[model samples]
Target: MSASRPVRRVDRQALQGLAHPLRVQLYDALVSEGAATASELGRRLGESSGSTSYHLRQLERHGFVETDPARGTGRERWWRATEEDLRTRGADFEDDPSAAEAYRILDTEWARSRRGRHESWRASRREWPMPWREAAGESTSHLRLDVEETAELMAEVVALMSSWAERTDGRDGDPRYRSVEVQANVFPNGRPPGVSTD
Candidate 1:
């Protein structure tokens, strides 16, 4: 979780730009794997260079990615995601049916990508060192809470994660440090069989 950058609230136009599956994958690759050339992304994603270059330009147009001037030669360009955290509210696009649809698509695809990454990690978990294998996993807890309480809990969790990220921001190039993914999902589950809403 890189919280050094501010979270971007996706607007209708940006939503449309990001709704495409390939664009979402491209953006996720840059965020998760760091900067890369379009050709590199194409090879990793199994897409043609022409296809990746086109989508990368579209992502740039929407402010989702930008060239990494520090890397790449004059003939090649490296791109990185502009923001690690992006959020969208359906309420913002309630009146615009198409934008609403785009929001749904973006949300679904992003979740799918997250799940895929987690699954991939699980498949390769044994290949990592013992310390990492011990640390890398998931946890779930169910609690009874009203809407406001749930929101409060989620906010606190996010704040803590951001603080950790900020504290460790300068540790780049450290041999002991590896890119770690942090995901938190907080939402109300349906009432338990014997539980009452009241």
Candidate 2:
């Protein structure tokens, strides 16, 4: 699906605003499952309507989510993710300890949520159609590269995903189309081959 807006680079202020675990979960739900009202989200997330509503408002204030204009009435208030891809770097907050802590919190929660989604998919893969079962899965590649090369590789991967998103922009209502998650992890192996910690 197409983003309603362009890609958003998350600043320190936004990062701090979105650092809460519940808020992150709420935003993730809207992104992965489309729009829903506070009560509906509460039911799915096992949270109180009041809690979800409060957290959703926080997410909205930081521009991570927005009211779904097409879905609910004025009182119902359906919420959906803004569709903008968010990019953040730990380096951005290196000078500010509190901001760094906020980044860490958001990063940890985001990674945990992603892992949970993959685990859920794995658990239910057998229930899916044969084509999807065969097509969807994970992969890893080991490469020995310096920092610059690694960055270049990630940039290419982002470009590829963005192109695919553009290619499938208007296919939201198609029955065969599914919400799929594609994750990429690039990092140095712990300690490296000849590192000395002592």
- Among the numbered candidates, top TM-score falls to 2
State the lDDT of candidate 1 residue by residue for 9-84, as single tens digits: 8888888998898999999998777789999999998999999999999999999999987788888999988845
Scored against the true structure, residue 66 in model 1 reaches a CA lDDT of 98
Backbone steric clashes in candidate 1, count: 0
User: How would you encode candidate 2's per-residue C-alpha lDDT over 138-185 as one tens digit per residue?
Assistant: 788999899899999999998888888777775655787888889888
By TM-score, how accurate is candidate 2?
Answer: 0.92
Q: lDDT for each of the candidates?
A: 0.86, 0.87
Q: Pick the candidate with the highest lDDT.
A: 2
Error at 7, model 2, angstroms: 1.8
> TM-score, each model?
0.89, 0.92
Model 2 spans with C-alpha error above 4 angstroms: 1-5, 192-198
Question: How does model 1 score by TM-score?
Answer: 0.89
